[model samples]
Target: MLSKFVAAAALAGAVVTAPAAAFDKPQTTYKVFQFPQDRIPRIDGEFSDWDMVPESYVVGQDQMTDQDGGHHNPDKTLNIRVKVGWVKGLNRLYFLYEAKDDYWDFSLPGLHNDTFEVVVDADLTGGPLIDVQHQDIWKPEWVGQRASKTDPRVPGSLTHWYSHGVQAQNYHIMTPHKDKDWAMAWGSPTWIKNFPFANAAQSYKFTPGQSGTYRLEFYITPFDHADPEGPERSVESKLREDALIALGWIVIDYDDVKTDAKNGFWSLSTQRPMFGLASDLPLFKLMPIENAKLEARWSWKVVDMDRRLVAFHDDSVGKATGWHWDFGDGTSSTEQHPIHAFAKPGSFVTILDVTGPDGTSRRSKVWDVQLR
Candidate 1:
């Protein structure tokens, strides 16, 4: 089944045209590793969970450029490795950040702290992602009017309420946050960083202004439309295997505390303003789990609950050549995907048997697809 799926996906991929590139390094494409559902990484400040991921998926400091030009040689002053991942059925994006720096600065209570800023355009709705970059507010007529608190185009006005971070999102994650939140969602929708939407953990041994290594593990849900009003009116970006999204990050390295000068603004995307411009973010493909084992798996959805109709899809892995589904109603089908309707409503045991080169596998669901 997996081979067949791969072949069909490859054929489909060949026919699909690539999206237009709006940022630097148009030819570059990063991969978001797909973690098997059972082996999803935990949000613990540890590296063991990431051992299953291959080294090739790691995006290190070598791939980044110092946009601020403060650190001409990053390897000597700072180094970082980032790995992005996603689970099959979850919309959240997981990250493992490991870094070593000659100086670690995070004593400040505000934005001046050392940070790891991330930007995501999960739906590729590329454009400005920050309030100040909103097209309507930047018009000539609204330029000087923004200073007035009563102006609708001002920062906290109605225009900013719905415009900022509506299409995309930016997260300013403090490297080792102290006495504050883990990250600041750079828009009106600050709720995106809270629990149930996001979570984080960190491990470090150095104090503020000391030199040491740090480890951070976290996950955040990417939203296609994250309304400032709250999650009730928002929309989460539907994540699926092989989907391509735009994502990038920057490392705000602050070495000195006495002066306000930052050490470097190292960025994965070549563009410096990628933090606020979704168009400047680079492409990242949600990859399939590598070396997945063959198994019989299927899911069903009620097409018409009143009519007792259900649509069943084959989700088995490996090169399945034949499929047999027993609908538990004395009816059976050999179709890879089938739609069936029950004559009466009751608990039933449905079984799906898939045969491949590796042999046969069976999956049974008891009373999982039932209607009154």
Candidate 2:
């Protein structure tokens, strides 16, 4: 079943017909801080873990604009600061959201609560990703019409089951949620917010109607093809160093509980429809770790079991002048990256030694390479 899903996902990726739409801020690109694997932030809703991040990485209120007629007053009502991060070898994006609102209104049981809405287009496969924005199926004349499951104009394949949220993702995260799930994975495949794909933690000291500060910490996996069925049919976006992805966020502030009108829609992207359109999101580059010390790290893949061929990759940090590999079979090589055919099929310990101006470092894997 897993193999079938992988094949389907690969086929979908290959048949992509539309080009990514032009990004909103073409002249500007944001940075996604890279966290060392050992220094990844904890999702405890505490700011102490983020002390290592520089002030430059913080996307503050100055970057957000009130798209809803500029009614939002940060100085008098709401203020927010957000930071994004990623770790190498992991297909996940981490976030830290801090906000202060004059009146925190989250008493509602549904979509009326304050929200930190996030949208991600990992591969930049542009166009409308939500069902309501489907160009051909969703008619403009039905704008104010009530929705019905049996409506002939809207098909389940286009509206609810397959298309929406499969290419890109939208997360409507309830701010300081009390009696609801942390976020609503706004389309099909609601399992996207569960463990292994996403997790969230929020902290607040005040009641729903009180004014106070709120902190939210969370991480989510971006998918290139997030199938409506589940993970078995999904393709996670491969996250790497120095790669660019499209992402944006909106702060949906609701000040009063009496009326249904929202206070403001402050957004990171200049385009107002960024929430539903993947192309409108801004570019965010995954940055390399700063001031990193020289360290040795390596990985291996079994190229061919019949020939006992194994390929090694150098994933070391910082500049290195030399490398040494011990195949643990009484043989060795000095290649930075090497492919070796083992003498026979057996579990073998592998080690890589790197030497640079800084110093020498070593990494070893115990009985990891097995050929049969």
The clash numbers for all candidates, in the given order, read 4, 0
Per-candidate TM-scores read 0.84, 0.82
Candidate 1: residue pairs that collide? 1-318, 1-319, 1-320, 2-318
> lDDT score, residue 22, model 2?
71
Tell me the spans in candidate 2 whose CA falls farther than 4 Å from its real position.
Answer: 1-21, 69-76, 133-161, 328-334, 343-347
Q: What is the lDDT of candidate 2?
A: 0.80
lDDT for residue 305 in candidate 2, whole number 0-100: 79
Model 1 poorest ten-residue lDDT run: 139-148
Cα lDDT tens digits for candidate 2, 64-153: 877764554433478899999999988999999999998888998988898999999886665676755455644312212223455435
**TM-score for candidate 2:** 0.82
Candidates' lDDT values, in order?
0.81, 0.80
Q: Can you list the residue pairs that collide in candidate 2?
A: none
